[model samples]
Structures are given as structure tokens and as C-alpha cells.
Target: MNKLIAWIVFLSLALGGCATKVSTSFDRQADFSRYKTFCWLQGCEFTFTGPSYMNDSAVVNNLKNAIIKEMAEKGFTYDDQSPDLLLDFHVTVENRQTNVYRFEEDRFLQLDPIDQSDVYYFLEGTLIMDIADRETGQMIWRSSASRYLELNPEMTERNLRKGIGIVLKKFPPKER
Candidate 1:
């Protein structure tokens, strides 16, 4: 019985640790160093050209501010006109349902209790950031991150910042 309980606890902690995942890709031919100035283009939906999801201004503002700060820290100037890079952002949220099952052994070694099964429904959010060349209008770098969201605004902002920081860490790919 103790071994079963320990196994259950270990599984629970492992599943809970599956948090945000971030991935990035960039054009190899593009000279990242040439991107000195950037300006915000309207955030896209998914196709990179579709209308943006602007249902909440507060959320949008928070994201824009975070991106600006991150870019500035990377030594990129924010320019509205004639910028070297154009930055576009997109966000999506999905409701995910997961079932967690707990098991108990019986004397027969075949019977197990199913009463510990739990269903969880939570929001998973994805944010995509694209950097494109203003002159050629070609995408140079792109990053996308997906993570579980918090209900509180403050917590949500903190998570957003953390996610963005992680995604942009590899920006301007190191010269080889």
C-alpha cells in the first residue's frame, strides 16, 4: 500500500511539471546583426496575415510592453518608421481536458479501484512572436511558446514575462 501511494505521488508531480514549452526558428541566410531597429506590426491570428485577436486591450498592452522591454534589452531600438525589423505577435488560448487515474491493488492482483480518477480542465495559452525584415518583408526569426495560464492578472503577467524571456533567449542566433 505504501509503494502504491508513493508511485501515485511521483506520477502526479511529474505530470504537474509539464509546464510551458518554447521553440524558435530563424532564417539562416538572414544577418541577425543587421536588425538594429524594430517596429510593431499588427498582431496576427495564426496565418501571419489574418486579423488579430484584440478582444482584450489590457492583455494586449501587457504583451506589447513585455516584448518592447525584451527587445530593448537586446539592444534593439523601437522605431515606428523605416525600421530594420518588423515585429508581429499572436496569441491563442485553448481549453484542454485531461484525466488522471489512480490505482489500488486487490488480493486477486487483477482488481483495481477506479474511484480516484480525476478530470481536469484548464486553459493553455500560446504566444507567437515573428520578426521580419522591413525592406524585403520576409520573416527572419519566429518564436512560439505554450503554457498553462493563471487566473489572476498579476500572475498571468508574470508568467507571460517569464515565457517571453525564455523564448527570446536564443534570439539573434550565435555566429558560428
Candidate 2:
């Protein structure tokens, strides 16, 4: 019973640590209200840095759709010809490993124990979104969301949507 409880606690901690993390920063002086329409920045729509598998078109489209949805929710329209704000996004994936040690009690001898160590490897992905003023060409707002990568296509799409939602939640920062 004690071992079962310990395992449950360990699993909870491990999974909780893998949750998505998001951070954002913006120019407080910038007039966010003036930004009405937005379009992808020239040569900066899809910036990716990672393995070939991580650069799939499906993933890119998923990200683009998610961003568009978020912007629309904020009453922003898409205007490619002449936009008030330029949008850019970047995706990066990196290898990461975690080491875990497991100890087991010897059934026959309680005094002796067995120690087992294991190293688990995974991919960590980060999504960065940048919003810049079209006329000034200066960044106005930026946000990034990071989490462990999943190989499954469905899971990947879900993660991207969730990450984008969380990062863009602070968009059009409340006037202070």
C-alpha cells in the first residue's frame, strides 16, 4: 500500500512538471488599441528550427490557424495588403533527457536493496509569437509557450492550439 501511494505521488509530480509554460512581454508605451488589422510579416511567417520531422506543414498550418483564431477573438482582422501590425512566429524543438533512480527492496533480505537508474529522452518544443508595428518596424508584443513534444499528429495539434491560446491570452494588454 505504501509503495502504491509513493508511485502515485511520483507519477503526479512527473506529469505536472510536463505542463505547458508560457511567458509574455510587451511595450507598455505602445498603443495596443491602434492595432486593428494584422498580417504576417514578410519572410517571417513560419520560422522553424528543429529536426525535419518537426517541420511538417500540417503543424505549421495548425499553428497559423490557432494564431488567427486568437487574433480574431481579440477583434483583430487579417489584412495582407496594408496592416497595422506585422505578425511573426517561430518554432524550435530541442532534445532533452531526464534521469530517474528507482530503488527496490529485496524480497528475501530487507537489509539489502537494489538501485536502478534510467535516462529518458524527449523533445522540448517552444513557440514564439511576435507582433510588431508596421510603420515603426519595432516589436510591440511577444509571447512564448514551451512544453514537451508529442510525436502523435493529433496530440501535436492539440498541444499547439493549447499553447497558442495560453500565450495569446494576454494579447491587447489592458490599458493601465
Candidate 3:
């Protein structure tokens, strides 16, 4: 039974780690089908905090390439001048402290609460992608992906691409 309990705990944590938290929102009245072209807004730059790697030019370029590929796969052409949709990217980092608790239970069905509270501080990064109507200059769609940053350069780049893909998958929001 102890082995079973251990396996259950391991599987639970493994599955939880595989889950990617993604969210998206859009203007309901916006006609997404009409958006066929995109361009980066003038003076666009990624905003970030924490380590330099988080805002490294190479890293930023890699992220942009990933986004461009995803957009093209979605049937949008990149137009330098005169585009239907304008795209913007922003990265925000925050230090988050979370407290985790552990409990002890007795065999007699009694529960004992101990002050086993553990506090963890981690850099939480958010990637925000905004799409707006080029002519009206009004945001029509937005997608955001957030994750704790703590990995090697290669893994970080991989995760960045994965995060962007997950966020953009909800593009052209489904009809009601």
C-alpha cells in the first residue's frame, strides 16, 4: 500500500507539471475572419524584469519568430506596411511568494496540524500578446501565458515557444 501511495503522489505531480495555464480574451463584435494581415507596431519592444536572459535580444527574437510562424499557420500574412492587424508583445516579471502547508494524520483518525508552512519565492513571468485593428487602433484580441521562470537557456527557449503556441491557439476566438 505504501508503494501504491507513492505512485499516486508521483503521478499527480507529473500530470500537474504537464498542464500549461493559458488564457485569452477578445472583443466579441470584432470580425476575426477579416483579419488576414499583421504587422508589428512601430517602436514595439518586449517589456521584462528580472535577469538579463529574460529580455535578451536573441531570446526576444526567437520568441518573435515563434509567434510569426504560428500566425502564418493561422492564415495571416506579415505585412510591413498597411496591415489589417497590429501586433504587440510585452513581458512582465513579478516575484511571487507562496506558502505551502503539510499536515500529519494519526492512525486513530485524528488530525494534527503542524506549522510546517513553507514559503517559496519565484520569478513569475507573463507573456502578453495583443492584436488590434490597425486602422481603428483598438485592441480586438489578447492572449496571455504565465509561468515560473527557472530553467536553462535551451529549455527556456523551448518553454517560451510552447507558451506562445498555447496562448495563440485560442486566436480567432470560437463563436458562441
Candidate 4:
């Protein structure tokens, strides 16, 4: 009996711990998938067309390098005037509120004890990236990644890279 119980407990724990840590809300791969391939262009080096409110030089440099690496890996070349896609980016940090509650039931209702917390929000500095058509100068593609923003620099950078990669996975739409 003791051995059987131990075996069951061990199996239960192992099974539970093996679960995935990824979010269960949306099939991340399928979300906004309809817009995966916005336009077909290549090797378009993006410029820092936006501003970074963080004022952290290290962070900025890190972002630039990460983006360049990612773009290069995707075989996208960068040019100033005749480039297939005009690349530009920015970084922003904003202060925002999370959850708010009221002590309505208690006598504290009169006192109005509302608690607030301070958190750093990191959005993909460039709220929008306009991928223009070299021939017509038309905005062929527009991408946006809005996030609560991570506080740690490394975390922030990682999040930015991941967000961009995920968004661009479906770029250069394939013709059916």
C-alpha cells in the first residue's frame, strides 16, 4: 500500500511538472496570421525613425544590434533610398496603472483606500513600422507590438526581439 501510494504521488507530480509554461489564451502562431505576409521585399535595413524615452545608451545599442541580427538572419538587405522596405524603430517607457479596487463594503469606504503600484512599461519603441514600397513610396506594411513593458534591460530586449520575430514570421505573404 505504501509503495503504491508513493508511486501514484510521484506519477502525479511528474505529470503536473511536465506541463508547458506557455500562454494558453491564443494560438500565438495563428493570431493576426492573416497579415503574416504584408509585402514581398528583402534586405531592407531599418533606421531608428523613433525615439527612446528610457535614455539608456546600452539599451539602445543592444536593441539596434538585436534588430540588425534578426533582419540579417531573415536575408533582408538594408538600403537608404531604393530599399525594398524602409526600416525604422523606437523605444518608449511609460508609467501606467494595473488593477484598482475600492473598500465599498467596509467603513473604509469613506476613507477611500485605493492602492497603486509603480511598474515600468516597455513597448516596441516604434508603435508602428511602415514597410514602404520602393517603387511607389506607398506604405505596404504596418506592424505594431504593444506590451506592458519589462523592467529589466535584458528582459526588455528579449521581449522586444521575440515580439518582432513573432510579428514578422508571416511577412512577404505567399501567393496562393
Candidate 5:
């Protein structure tokens, strides 16, 4: 069991390694022509998809802080009571099952204690959404970003924030 668990962790860590590479295109695309002045409603909601967050294991503060900083610089104000734009996040963690078995002495052998181990994969992204005046409160404008995260708790927050920042940089939309 221990070995199997360890291997699972190892593989997850290997595949979920931090994203060291960086790209700085957020600002270049954050320009608005069709619409300029903006405001968030007074009572909007913020949320994320499952498996999109790191455990509260020390790096959460840094990750949250980075998001707040970048959003502010982009002219997005923080309003818990009211917000014109609703910030929502969607994430998915896939742990598809995989197994191996052997037969010996007319009996079958299981792969490991963790027989149904799986390959873990995840994606995290956020949407800055606004509801249109009519047409079922449709979307007005949105900015988003997403990326695979590393298994390391220490690396998760930073990578997630960076991903979010890059995605949101295109908010307000510019002619490209």
C-alpha cells in the first residue's frame, strides 16, 4: 500500500510540476474600445471548480494576494457586497483509473494495494463575467486563463495566480 501510494504521489508530482516558463502578453491585450467605463455590481459571487485550489498549507495567502493585486491593477475593484462583474472559476481534476495484474499458481494477482490507482490531471481557470441587460442575462465581456498545475503544494498557488493573471489580461478586449 505504502509503495503504491508513494508511486502514485511520485507520478502526480512528476506530471504536475510547476510551470517555470513565463509569457507577458496580459497588458498588451487589455484594451477596451467598444466599451470603456465599467463597474461591478454590488453583490456578485466568486467561485472555482473542484480540485482547482491548493490545500491551506502555507502558500494560499501568496496565491490569493497575487490575484488581488493583479485584478486591482487592471481596474477591477474589490466588492464583496456588490459587483458589476462576477468572478467565477472552473476547474477539473481527472484521476482516471489504471491497473495492472498478474497471474500465478492459477490465481490472479493485483497490481498493488492501491489496485485502482489513477493518473491525476487537473485544469484551473477563472471568468470575469457580466450579465447583459436582456436575453436571459447573457454574458457581456469575459477574460479567462487556465493551465495544468503541479502536485507540489508550494508550487500550486503561484502557478494558479500566474495563470489567472495571464488569462484576465485580455479583459475589456482590444482590437487584435
Candidate 6:
């Protein structure tokens, strides 16, 4: 019974640690209804700043596609020639390390280990999106989502999609 409880507790903590964290802030005074057309900020669709693994074309494409889809679903049209809002995004990945201590009991002797601390390393990735008025060039809305990245390409892609979706979920903030 004790062993089973220990395993359950350990599993719960491990899973919860990998969950994504998202935050959003917007200019309360800005009128969201006046925005309709959108275009990428500067000459590029998106900008990335991170290690080589996260700065590849595939990552950029995935980010762009996710954002475009979200914006389109929100009744926003993409126009480079003339737009009411300019959109920009930045991606960053950093190495992180953490020390975790777990109590381990000797299966045969039922004695706890003296030292059960372990060091774990992971890659933390963050996606930041910004929306600014074209004429004023002042940011109207912004959001960011961060999570520990998986080594697998498929899982990484899934995480990216999920993060982008959550980040933009509150865009075009309701009138206050």
C-alpha cells in the first residue's frame, strides 16, 4: 500500500511539472472592434531568437501556420499592403536544470535511502506574440506561453500548436 501511494504521488508531480504556462496582457483603452485587417510586423512574418535547434525553418513554419490559422478563425484578414494591426512573434528556448529529492525505500529492508536527490535537465521554450496598431505602432495586445520542450519532434510540434492556441485564445479582448 505504501509503495503504491508513493508511485502515484511521484507520477502526479512529474506530469504537472510539464504543463504549459500562459499569460496575456492588453491595452484596456484600445478599441478591439476597430481592428480588422492584419499584417506581419516589419518585412518578415515572424522572428525567432534561440538556439540553433529552435531557429530552423520547420519551427518558423509551424509557428506561422498556427498563428495564421488562429487569426483567420477570429475574422481577421491578412493584408500586407494595408492593415489596421501589425502582428509579430518571438520564440526563445533556454536550458534549465532542477534538483528533485524523492524518498526511496529499500524494497527488501523497508528502509529509506539516505540520499535520493537527482538532477534533471530540460529545455524551456517560450512563444511571445504581439499585436500593435499600424498607424500608432503602439502595442495593443500581447501574450506568451512557455513550457518544457520535448526531445521528440512530434511532441515538440504538438506542444507548439497547443501553446499558440492558448496564447491567442483571449485575443481581441472584450470591451471593458
The CA lDDT at 7 in model 1 is 59
**Relative to the true structure, how large is the alpha-carbon lDDT of every model?**
0.70, 0.75, 0.70, 0.45, 0.44, 0.75
TM-score of each model, paired residue for residue: 0.77, 0.80, 0.72, 0.50, 0.45, 0.80
Worst 10 residues of 6 by lDDT: 105-114
lDDT of 3 by residue, 64-159 (tens): 777778889889998876789988878776776655444444421343435654555556667788889988999998888876654343534566
Where in model 2 is the C-alpha error above 4 Å? 1-13, 43-51, 106-115, 151-158
User: What's the distance in Å from true for residue 26, model 4?
Assistant: 22
Off by over 4 Å in 6: 1-10, 102-113, 153-159
TM-score of 6: 0.80
Clashes of 4: 12
- Candidate 6: clashing residue pairs, number: 0
* Residues 77-146 of candidate 1: C-alpha lDDT, one tens digit per residue: 8887678888887777776766555555553245454666566566677778888998898998999887
Q: What 10-residue stretch in candidate 2 is worst by lDDT?
A: 105-114
lDDT of model 4, residue 35 = 29
- Model 3: CA > 4 A from native: 1-18, 43-52, 99-121, 149-157
Candidate 2 TM-score, true structure as reference:
0.80
Candidate 2, 1-176: lDDT as tens digits: 33553455456756986788888999999999888999888743545544577567877677677777788988999887888999887777777776554445444134232354455677777878889999999999999988876544353556667777888888989998
Clashing pairs in 5: 16-150, 40-83, 40-84, 41-82, 41-83, 41-84, 42-81, 42-82, 42-83, 43-82
**Candidate 3: which pairs clash?**
none
Best by lDDT: 6
RMSD of each: 4.5, 3.8, 4.2, 12.2, 8.7, 3.7
